[model samples]
Target: MDMSMVWRQWLTRHDRVRDALPAVPLIVIAVAATAVGNSAWHEPHWDKVVWTALSCVPLVVRSRWPLQVALFTLAGDLTLMTVVSHTSPTPAACLVAVYTLALLGDRRTAWIVGFVAAVTIAGVYSATHADSVVGGAGLVRFDFALGATVLGRTVRSRRDNLAAAKARAERAERTREEEARRRVTEERVRIARDLHDIVAHHITLVNAQAGVAHHLMRDNPEQAYQALAHIKDNSRAALDELRATVGLLRQPDDTPGSRAPVPRLSDLDNLADGFRASGLDVRVTRTGTPSPVASSTELTAYRIVQEALTNTHKHGSATRAAVVVDYGAKGLRVTVTDDGRPGVPKGAGTGHGLIGMHERAAAVGGTVSAGPRAEGGFQVVAELPISPRSRLTPA
Candidate 1:
C-alpha cells in the first residue's frame, strides 16, 4: 500500500538473495582479472581457463563452508601459479582465501595457514625466478597473507563480543520477568487475606443479628426493631471496610474515596464494643505508654486482634474474651485469649484464619503464635517491631 510497507515486504521475501549478495563483488573481480590476464598473454590455454574458473567459483560458497572454500581456493591458486604464468588472478584469489581461513578458523589454525602460505610463496618464487629480486616479491606476497589473516581475526573477535553481550541482555530480561511475577503473586495473597478478614467478621455479626430479629418479630416488637437496626449497621460497616481495602487495588485516578482512613491500633476499643454487642463478652486492657509506630505495623496489630476475636466467637465456645496490649521500648505486643471450655473442639472451617494472622504479622516484621491454651481455651499472641531502625530494616 505505502512505499515503506512495500520495501519491508520485499526485504522479507528476499532473505536468501541478501545472504548471497556479498559474494557477487568477489566473483566479478575474479572473472575480470582472469579475462585481463588472458588478454595480456595473448593465449587462452585449457589449463589456465580451468584454473581461473575453479578459483572464482569457490568464492560464491565461501560463507556456507568458509574453511573448505579457503582450502580449495588456496590449492587451486598454488597449482596455477606453478604451471601458468605469474600474471594470472591467482595472487588476488589467494589473498581472499587467507582472509577466509583466519576468520573461520581458530588462532592456531590461522597461524598454521600463515606459515604454509609463506613457505609456498618462497618455494615457488625461488624455483621460477633466478635472482634476489624474486625474494623481495615473495616477501610482499607473504605480507598480504599476513594482513588478511589479521583483518579476519579482528572481525571474528568483534562478532564473538557482540554475541556475548546479546546473551547477557536476554538473561537480564528473564530475571526481570521472574521478579515481576513474584511481586504479583505476593500482592494477590495480601488482597485475599484482607478480603477474608473483612467479610468473615462483619457477615458473621450480621447473620447473628438477622436471626435475633426473625425470632422476636411477633412477640417483642421493640427488640426485633433493635435487632434489625444492628443488622443494618453491621452490613454498612462491612461495606465501608471492604471499600477501603479494595480501593488499594484501583488506579490512583480511578479510586472511589481512597482517602478513607484505614483501621489502626486506636480503633481496637470500638472493634471490641461491636463484638460485645454480638454476645461476645469482650474486654480490652493496655499497659505501658504507647509509642509511635509505622502505619503498616499498627494495621497488622489491629488485624491480629480482630482475627483472634472472630475465631473465638466462631470456635472457642467462650463466654468471655480478653485483649491485652503491652508497649515496650523495642516493640508492641498484643495477646487475645478466651475462657472457653477445653473440651469444645475448634471450628471446622478452613484454617486460613490463623494463617492470615501469621502472614499479616510477618509482613510487619513480627511473629505470631496461635493455639489452644494449656489451661482452658485458645489464645493468640503477636509481637510487632516499632522502632525506627526496625522499620528501615529489610524483612
Candidate 2:
C-alpha cells in the first residue's frame, strides 16, 4: 500500500512538471531580453520591465496555441524596437518564436513560419543599422535552416516509430483471437466423442436384452424377467456415465486452481465388465510391463475398445471378443477383434462405430484402422504416443 501511494505521488508530480516546460522557458527569455534592451538604450528601466512582464502572458498558452503565442510575443518586441528606432533586441524573440512553430507544427508549416520570421526580422534590423545589415541576414539564415531541417527530422522519426508499434499490437491481437477459436472447436469435438462412447455401447445392451425378453416371454417367463432386469441396470449405468462426462461443462469452478474428475487408464475394467454383463464373451490381455501413458492417450484407448465391442454386439452374433493391450518403446498399441457371431445371426448396427473409434485415436495424436483382417475376422487397431505428461503439442 505504501508503494502504491508513492507511485501515485510520482505520477502527479510528473504531470505538473510536464505542463510547466516550454512556457517557463519562454517567460524567462522575455524578461532577460527586455532588461538587456533597456540597459543598452539608457531609458527608464521600469517601463522596460512592464513591457517585458506583459510578454510573459503569451507563454502560458504556448502548448495549445503555439503559433499564436509566437506572433503575440513578436508584436511586443516590435513595440520595444519602435521606441529605440533600429536598436531593437528582436533577434532573440524571433529565434524563440521560430522554435515554438517548428517543435509543434508539421515540417512544411514550420519551414514557412521560420522563413517569414527570419527574413522579416533581418530586413527590419538592416534598415535600422546600415553598417551591419548583410552580416545580420547571414546569421538569421543559418538559425532558420537548422530549426527547419534538423529538429523537424527528429519529430518525424518519433511519429513513424509510434505508428509501427500500433501495427504490431493489432497483429498480436488477431493471432490471439484465432487461437481461442481453435481451442473452442477442439473442445466441442472432444465432448461429442465422449457422448458417443458413453451411450452407443449401452444401446447395444438394451437392444439385445429386449430381443431376449420378446423371444422367451411365453415359453420361459423366468428367463425373460432376468433379461428385463439386465436392461434396466444397463440403462441406469449409461445415464450415470453420461452425467459424469457432461457435468464437466456446467461446473462453474473448473478453471485454473479447480478440481475435476477426468477419466484415465484405470477405468478400463469397469468398461469391460459392462460389455461382459451384456452377454458378450470378452477377454483382456497385456504384454510387456506397462509404462505410464498420457491421460489423453489412456482415455482414448479405453473409448476405442468400448466402441469396437459395441460394434461386435450390434452387428455380429459373435459369442467371443478379445481386447489386447501392448506397450512398446514408442507408444501404446491396442487392438479389439472378434470373429463376429461364429455364424451371422443379427442385423447391421450403428454404422458410425468405426468412425467414432478412429476419431478418438486421432484426438490423442494417434492413428486407427478398422477392417476385416486376412484371417477372416474384423479388427480395430490404434496407436498412441506414450509421453505420460504430454497430450497435445503446442501450436
Candidate 3:
C-alpha cells in the first residue's frame, strides 16, 4: 500500500537475494576498473570484458559455498593474466571470495585455503610478470588476500564470544528456576510439619478428655462437666493454631484472616499442660537462663518438644514424658525422653513426624539425635546455635 511498506515486504520475502545485495557494488567496481585498465593498457576490449565477467560472476554464489567460489574465481583470474597478458579488476573479485571463505569456513580449512591461494597467485604472477600488463600489481593482490583473511578471522572470533555469552545466560536462568523450586518444596514440607504437630497434639487431648467424660457421666458429673469444658477449650485452641498455620500459605494482601503469632519456647509450658490434662504426666526442666533467640528458632524448639511429646503420647505406652532445655554457651540444647516400652505404639503412623523434626532442625544449622534409649524408652535431642549479634539485637 505504501512505498516503504512494499519495500520492507519485498526484502523480508527475498532473504537470500537481500544477503547478495553487497556483491552488487563489488561487481560494478570490478567491471568498471577492468574496463579502465584495458583502455589504459590498449588491451583487446572484448577479451578484458570476458575475463572480468568470469572473475566477478562467481561472487554471486560466494555466500553459499565460499571456499569453492573463492577457488573458482582465483583460477579464472590467474588464467586471464597468464594466457592473455590482461590487466583487469579480477583481483578484487578474488579478494571478496577469500574474505567470505575465511569468515564462513572452519578455522583450519580457512587457514589452509588462504595460504594456498596466496602462494598460487604470487607464483602465477612471478611466472607471467615479464609479459603480463598486471604483473606490477602482484604484491597488492597478495596483500588484499591476507587482509581479508585477517578481517574475517576477527569477525568469527566476535561471533564465537557472543554465542558463549548467550549460552551462559541461559544456564544461569535455569539455575535460578531450580533454586526457586527447591525453596517452594521446602516451604511445603514445613507447612505439613506444622499442620501435623498442631492437629496431633490437640486431637490426642480431646480424645482422652472425651473418654474421661464418657466414663464419668453418671458417677462424677462435676468431673464430666470439667472434661467437656476441657474438650471445648482444646478444640478452640486447635482451631486457632490451625488457622495460623494455614495463613502462612496466603499472600500478604489476601486477608481472610491475618497470620496469628507462631508458638514460641514460652508456649511450651502451656503445651505440656494440655498433655497433663490428657492424663500423661509431662515434666519440663530448664538448665540455664533462657537466652534471646530468633523467632524461627524459638518456634522450632517448641515444635520439637511438641512433636516428641505427641509421639510419646500417641505412639508409645508412656505414662510420663520429660522435656529438658539447656541454654549452653554454644547454643540451646533440647532433650525429650519417655519411660515407655521400647516398641511401636498402638496406632503409629508414617514416620514423617521424625523426619520432619530432623528437617526442621537442619534448616537452622542444628542437629537432632533420636532413637530408643539404652535404659527403657525413646529419646530425642536437638542443639540449635544462637548468633551473638542476634542475641544482642532486636528483630
Give the higher-lDDT candidate: 2 or 3.
3
Per-model lDDT: 0.76, 0.68, 0.78
lDDT of 3 by residue, 24-48 (tens): 7765654565556423733335656
Give one digit per residue, the lDDT tens place, for model 1 in 1-395. Answer: 89999977886677545434544565555455555653374334555666666676676666566677767777877777777755523355666767777887888988778667766765665566553424677667667777888888999899999999999999999999998898778888888888889888888787777777888999998988988888888887888888887777888688465535788888999888778777889999999888888888888888888888888887778989999999989999999999988777867879998999988877777899988877888989998889423322211
Best by TM-score: 1
For candidate 2, the 10 contiguous residues with the lowest summed lDDT are: 386-395
- Which residue pairs of candidate 1 clash? none
Order of models, best lDDT first: 3, 1, 2
Tell me, by lDDT, which candidate is best: 3
Residue clash pairs of candidate 3 = none
Which sequence of candidate numbers ranks them by TM-score, best first?
Answer: 1, 3, 2
Q: Number of clashes in model 3?
A: 0
Q: TM per model?
A: 0.83, 0.60, 0.79
Off by over 4 Å in 2: 1-137, 252-269, 341-356, 388-395
